[model samples]
Target: MTVQDIRSFNRFYTHLIGALDHGRHLYAPYTLTESRVLYELAHAPRTDVADLRTQLHLDAGYLTRILDKFERDGLVERGPSERDPRRRRIRLTPRGRETAELLDERARQAVGTLLAGVAPEDRPRLAEALRTVRALLSGGRVPRPEDVVLRAPAPGDLGWIVQRNAALYAAEYGWNAEYEALVARIVADYAQDHDPRRERVWIAELDGRPVGCVMCVRDTAPGAARLRLLLVEPDARGLGIGDRLVAAVVAFAREAGCREVVLWTNDVLAAARRIYRRHGFTPVAEKPHRSFGKDLVGQDWRLDLRAASE
Candidate 1:
């Protein structure tokens, strides 16, 4: 077998054996589906069937069957919601809670034993890598929230941002190397002459991982600033990270005594345009530019910072 094939087979075998061992001890009289239901209820006692349907991505018929089994087995109780009689909520019974706790402990012990020999120093890194693998396998998505801190970019973060932006644009709109290189140049120049008082770069980090970035620079015009290189990772696009970053840069520009903030972007970035408009930016100009061997339309958007605050 090829080296990659052997490695894949070993990984699968290891997981399969570990799962079987866990099941042997944890599977009481309950089926796997039943146990899953009980576990969900134990964690979220007032959960509705619709929430469970979405979380587990199960069809109505299958979920109903499982709920019926759980009810008959005395593992869960379902009733009409107090606020909405049309909705039904599920809760684990006392006996079900006990069973779930036992199963949880057993599964944890089994996995802990499997990793017992791994050094403590490496466990966190290993767990993070596994989580990333799981996320990629599931759908290559990440969650974004305001509690996510946007800070100065770390080592390798700018490179990752550049690569992701190039790949995503290429896949979605046929952008190429010239576009990537332009982004790289903007980032490199900012890095080379970073000014804490007048120019700043920020990266949005959620759960200690970089998810988005933006840069504010001194403008050529007196009392003006420019926002450049604003990007959010594909998985994190919908979570308002872009809006947060834009707001931050605008606030920073105001603090730096700037009367206006300007930005340049492609028409393809409709969402970003929407954000800029919502923050009171007006489209001041548009021009056709050839880059990455593609004719692209670029828009120059300007936000009057002084007018916004007043």
Candidate 2:
């Protein structure tokens, strides 16, 4: 990405927060930098000037000035470090703590207002995006599993499924537009006619973005469901999203009184196949077919949920 692009985004973000204005944040007469310093002092245990300077990367003179102002306002207390009398530690006075609490409440309200503009369905994906951004900037720290959420598709998700499936397949497998058309058709049919009781779609989200999707739909067979369009984004693979999606399909099929669930895939989709196998699906049929702009062997797999019920 160009530096201009980065600068543009920085400008947009700073403007969004009114960060350049003094006393704009929480309207508490403190600059954003001063507020940050107050927050650090209020929260940090055994905070010394050196530690604050190092952590905040503030000039010693600027920090000294802020602390001096805080001292004058009776919002901060300076104490000799218990460990070393030469080192001074900082603590917030009661008034300072009260101010900190007010700042904290204002910060929370600001975030709430910002997020209020985001659509409900998009919230999880937005959260996932923020986490990914944090992880990327934090030197590739892995996010915890609890941070991920699988949500039901809403409004625009069906379109996202078709678009992402087509784009990802073409990019990864050289599958052509015909594959996209097929996905579009499948999604359209599912949207138009599927029985809600027997079918469901799941979007696997990480860091506020859609990382994967799977759909279980009513099948042509009398008592079977078809698991279709199972896709986990390349970046989100190895996170067991595929397995969880398949498991959800199986569980839903059982709950819907379906005897079995089936899926079709190509031999080249080894990771997907492995997930299917782990979920007790067995390859039942295979045939060579010219499809999706490729000569490939298509395989059908079936999972018997009836036996599980028995």
Candidate 3:
């Protein structure tokens, strides 16, 4: 089939699926917006209005109206923030909590009912295809927050980073099987024997989606650490991700009592090389290598934490 034909079919399929889902709504009384607000409040009862606004991307007037309605209905209470009298915080009332819980359970059931017939094996494929479409449409940009957060990787996040990295690098550099296999091995090993104290994976997320990551693992040699599998989504590049990842790794290594940090990369990764150099890493070794069906030059770099601090 031609590209145009495939595109047309995709449009029709999306519209058909959306229509099917829309027709099957079991929640008779709650609007979608109200349900969403309930869901967000379910997890965080005392959320600031500003945070809710950002998360829902709602206009100020509209959000105020919804909050007012919810308050009048005894579903939620809004009051001045305890720490900051100028800001408002919203919390669910006891009755609101019960109602929200019921609604949430019903929503979960609705989703399960929709996907009941789909085979388990096909679910991953469906999700991946949808993600690809979203990435393409958004020009490869991943969700990011305006504020910076440094935290350990959450469940399933490391795997996501590995998957996104493999897919993106494969498409961008024509990397073959070997490179993919290497990333798989790294991720698997980390997952199998994760140590919060000696090794950690840090992820930077925007809008609850991971956009950058770095891993710091304890080295066999005492007082040494290895930095591995650093990556930022292509759309998230040029916003200091590389520098942030590197700095985070360095801080982690120091906190772990490592005297030095080491990393390896291909010479083709010029941008990464520049970031490392800017952060005090120096090339210690270089070699010609052939892997992934391509001949390339690789370099090993090291940054001495003690020396740099001194």
Candidate 4:
């Protein structure tokens, strides 16, 4: 949130990654900058030395020194550009390419080792957080739909459902802990036991992080499915995550042969209600209710899946 906080995290992360300015790094015998140049040369073979220097933002003198060292070691060869006789170009030798491969492999192994300690289910969340930080700091645009993933609930995701739902409702609508408890029970019931073939849940991920969720569970009626806990994080709302989650529920319910799908919602959730209606859910009943520290109008919606498929 503050400059100091960001700087502190940078310090911690650099140290954690062993990014010391010495000859000993994942790519040993080559300094970070040297290894970086080698990597660029390997990927962009026969690259213009001037273009490489500009891309990496290295000082002219510093870059000349590194290239000089590489040439002395027979790792690279400087020559004229292929199409132009006068323009300068540089290329990695076979030995340089081999060294670049080693650096890449070592970097991967090091990152894999560092990530091995994270819980398998939490890895996606961690990736999402990192992507978010990078995008924000780099002034990137919001995630596209291709970046969204719909996945089955994993370990700890149910708890995330309860916590995020509770916190968001409280912050947005002044809802109380009662809403949180209700969400807890719903996920807890699913956790205890549910027919996986007929009942399903989806966690919507944006850039590998959970940004939304929904559930389809068996209703009291024999052939009815109840849609519950449809939620999208506020930051991710306009990206069609809510629409994607709702569509998943409908598709799953139809595939499970449910005659009808039902859901209960308070009228205050206008965006969610719109998404439901767009997916062919109709408001079948409405009533005043006192719950979650508010006097809300609760509505019951039903979608005739059989009719919809027709």
Q: Which candidate is the best by lDDT?
A: 4
Show where candidate 3 strays beyond 4 Å: 1-148
Better of 1 and 4 by TM-score: 4
- The alpha-carbon RMSD values of the candidates against the true structure, listed in the order shown, are 14.5, 16.3, 11.2, 15.8
For 1-310, candidate 2 gives per-residue lDDT tens digits of: 7889879988998888774333465846888788888876644433677777876889999999999999999988898865578988887776886787688668867877787888989989987787766777668767544344566675689999999999999998999999999999999998898776788888887776788899999888999999999998887777767776776677667757899999999999988888888878999999999988999999999988877556
Candidates sorted on TM-score, descending: 4, 2, 1, 3
Q: What is residue 13's positional error in candidate 4, in angstroms? A: 19
Model 3 lDDT, residue 11, Cα: 100
| Model 4 local distance difference test score | 0.83
Between 3 and 4, whose lDDT is larger?
4
lDDT tens readout by residue for model 4, 13-104: 88878743233667678888998889777545556778778868899899999999999999999998755767779877767767877887
Per-residue error at 108 for model 1, in Å?
32
**Clash statistics: count for each candidate:** 0, 11, 2, 0
Model 1: lDDT to the true structure: 0.76
lDDT of 3 by residue, 233-303 (tens): 87777667667778767765775678999888999888889999998999999999997777889899999
lDDT of each: 0.76, 0.81, 0.76, 0.83
Candidate 3 residue-wise lDDT at 306: 97
Q: Which parts of model 2 have CA positions greater than 4 angstroms off?
A: 1-140
TM-score of 4: 0.59
Q: Per-candidate TM vs. native?
A: 0.55, 0.58, 0.55, 0.59
Best candidate, TM-score-wise? 4
